[model samples]
Target: MTRNIWTFITCGLLFSAAAVHAQSADIIISKGTDKTTIDASPFGASDPAGRMFIQVLTADLVRSGWFARGAQGASEYILSGSAGGGGGFVAQCRVAARGRSGTVFDRSYRGDANEVRRLAHEAADDILKALTGRDGMASARIALVGTLSGHKELYMADADGQGLVQLTGHKSVSITPSWHPDGDRLYYTSYAKGFPAIYELNLRGGSIDRVANYAGLNTGGVVSPDGRWMAMILSRDGNPELYVRRMPNGDPVRLTSTRRSAEASPTWSPDSRQIAFVSDMSGRPQVYVVGREGGQPRRLTLRGSENVSPDWGPNGLIAYSSRIGGRYQVCVLDPRSGDVKQITAPDADYEDPSWAPDSRHIAATRSIAYRSSVYLLDTLGDPPVALIDQKGDWTAPAWSPGR
Candidate 1:
């Protein structure tokens, strides 16, 4: 189909690949700064759902970088709550500093039995915000592409891998799932048409539309945080390069011109003024950044022989997967200092690192024995937590910016 026709189809449709390889590393736990200890009191004395709420909330708090699980022995804070209301599940949660300092959070959440976990997540987010002065990712969702049913399909789950929902039934190769700035819509590449084409799926309305179906390759479509442009990789102009197109409909503006080098995995900085992408212009795949308005590209990584899947976090850290000692591990780079810190141990190959909105934690794919699963790694301290326990090869996790 012609480019014009495809654009028309995408507009009418309303919406939207990453490559994967198998490798292995060791899991190394690093001790960093001390974490705040919070003692969590039990909730819901008589209701089973209330107890479930406390369990889920405790897990969320532990997964959050700011708090560690412990008893009321010398804890900095104490989280106590109760669940009641014979008709439905009602959670009354409160977080207070030890020694009668004050109550940071005192709120009540009411929901049906099916929403017990969600209610707990909401309470956890509020408690985090009240205590740490930072937003919590407990209520956020993550879009991922996995091969669970023998074919690559798009799937989504809560940040903790609960409330799993399958977004696409393409039964074909669907990859590179990206979230709209609003987090209610998603864009991904599906090969159901015998070629890679970008499609958009609306989570609220259950609708799917083709966003970009150009001739060559139409993949890696990430909507800018400002929701005004989309940075994607297209080869219609001869070589696979990064291009930024205005939202809804606008002619794509070519941003990179590395003649023989192919660019993949384009991510926008928090301010939306620059984009970090993967290119092999120097004979090996590495991360590079270029101005959003199209200018000379600047190389970012100097150590890794192969650095790809760059994700620019909201807190100004660029997290990417770097090949070290022949194994791909998650590493974060300070764009301003050129200092790099490897987060994952050399136990298993970790790739496709996506940062949470807080920027202190990262979600990436951990592969071992050729079996892949999504894992959440805290950049501050603590070990990586496996987000999903299901049996599937989950890869390319895109974390939402919280509701």
Candidate 2:
């Protein structure tokens, strides 16, 4: 397998070999920020599924960046939970503050026996919100393209990259997956019909619907946050230009009219009024923003020689991969002041940044030579952490809006 890291997102690549390995899901926000201590234990670290539950809960709390681990006597909050059952998976958790005698948080979760990890994640997130008043994304799902089976296919997994299941077995080429507002379906480009076209897959019902299959090229279909509109790249009108339609049934409104330049990877603003995309209009690809109502496009990135894969977050920050010092690194841009910051280390290649629901962290594909994996990058300056250690190339991660 050759390592074509730069053009992996634009042109799909396939790799051989597959292996199942679970890595620690621990993620910390930053070192200096004050994090309250909350401990969850006394269940079973040596037990079968109980151990799995504890590992997941510890990872979720530490990853949220709001809490830290403490000793039993010095901890600010103590959390006790039950995570074992003979039949169906059931979890019950309760939290109590140090000074208060009454329990501050109490909740129980029930799901299938195979969904124990998910139940644990939900419990951790619910307790996080109750104690810190901050939104938790432990239960968030990630949709990405993987070449594990020696063919390009769409795959999905939990935020920690567990319980990965293939979504599209087209056995052909499928890439560029985007989630709908409801999170029950995905909008992606596939060659199942022997042509590059856009389709939507319902996660629940397994129904695939074709969204766009224009003449020349049809790819990069992303729905707006509000779900009323969709922005995509189409070459039906000649050189691939940015197009927006009213979603279910509306006319395509062309946004860019460049003659020879190409446009790809369209992302929506939190308000769904503006769109940030990648365009090679200036002889080099850079991040650009255009209105959904169709207007003149404006370049948004000036610091990098090459920038691509712009993901606009709810906190008004756009994350993209920038070519810094001849290497692709993760960089975030404040579209307001034109300020740019590089968050990934410049030692390896990283691209296709998708912001998490909280906007405090990003999910992106980090490639070190021919191997690639999905990693979570903290916007607050913590070192990059791999969300999964499973073998095979995992690229183009799209994070769901934490449910």
Compare the candidates by TM-score and give the number of the best one. 1
Candidate 2 lDDT tens digits, 1-403: 1222322321211111001112111222223357899766544433567677777888888887778887876889988767666676667778898888989998887877677798888887888889877777788899999998777899998888888888988999999889998899899999999989999999999999988988889999999989999898999988899999897858778998999899999999989999999999999998899988878889887644799999998788899998867888887777876555566765689999998876688999998876888898887755578887776899999998878
In model 2, what is the error at residue 177, expressed in angstroms?
Answer: 0.8
Candidate 1 lDDT (Cα, 0 to 1): 0.84
TM per candidate = 0.90, 0.89
In model 1, the runs with Cα more than 4 Å from the true position are: 1-30
Q: Clashing residue pairs in candidate 2, if any? A: none
Best candidate, lDDT-wise?
1
Off by over 4 Å in 2: 1-32, 43-47
Clashes of each: 10, 0
